[model samples]
Target: MNNKRFVILASIAALGLSGCAGYREKRGFILDEQLSQAVQVGTDNKTSVERTLGRPTFTGQFNDNEWYYVSRSTSTFAFRTPRVIDQTVLRIRFDPAGNVTAVERTGKDKIASIDPYGRTTPTLGRRKSFFEEFFGNIGTVGSGGLPGGGGQ
Candidate 1:
């Protein structure tokens, strides 16, 4: 009976520890080094590149000639926000003839973190309490009416 209780407690502790373990996740297009390297500028066209590296993650906003293959790896511990550990943005640019013009790659140096200000957002207007806002518009609604429009 003691052994059984010990086993049960140990199992529960193991599961709890597992929940606290850091989790790593691979998101978006997972690039293959060899496959990505095989794509050569001036040699690989749209069709060939597509066949070699699969479809791109997304195309350029303005033109379809530029393609972006983005890969990111993230890690999260417990209940924290997932942080990017590895990032790769491979941009393949094509010319008018659809041949690869340039191959560019960017790493995690481009990642940006934005933290909002405080619990309340700062606005352009003066701050007012709840009751003030609820009753503030009562007198202002009729303040702009015509002076001589008193129902003749």
Candidate 2:
């Protein structure tokens, strides 16, 4: 009996440990150093860039000349919020004729931290209490009767 109980407890502990193991996920474009290096400014055009790096994750909203390749790795353990382990943003600028003009790379150092002020957002309207809202429309709604009801 003692040996059986010990074995059961050990198995449970092992299962729990396995459940706590962290998982890493890669999101967005996969960047290869060789492929990226193959692109040359003023020489590689839009077609060549697409052939080398595939489609970009996103293009500049106002202008299509700027292409962005984004890659991120996130890690999560159990139910905890996933944390960004690594991130890279590659920006390729193209001229009006669609020739590559410049290439830029950004990493995790560019990430920004923004903290929200509060749970509620301020709005532009009269505030009413629960009781006021529940009863405020009680008299106004039926006083005039339903539209086109024709008073009998």
The reply for model 2, stretches above 4 Å from the true place, is 131-152
Instruction: Give the alpha-carbon lDDT of every model.
Output: 0.92, 0.92
> Number of the top candidate by TM-score?
2
lDDT of residue 3 for candidate 2: 100
In model 1, the runs with Cα more than 4 Å from the true position are 1-12, 126-128, 131-152
What tens digits encode model 1's per-residue C-alpha lDDT throughout 1-152? 99999999999999989878888999899899999999998899999999999999999999999999999999999999999999999999999899999999999999887898999889898899999988986655445563544332
**Per-prediction backbone clash count:** 0, 0
Query: In candidate 2, what are the lDDT values of residues 1-119, reduced to their tens digit?
Result: 99999999999999989978889999999999999988999899999999999999999999999999999999999889999999999999999999999999999999998988799
Residue 149 in candidate 2, Cα distance off native in Å: 16
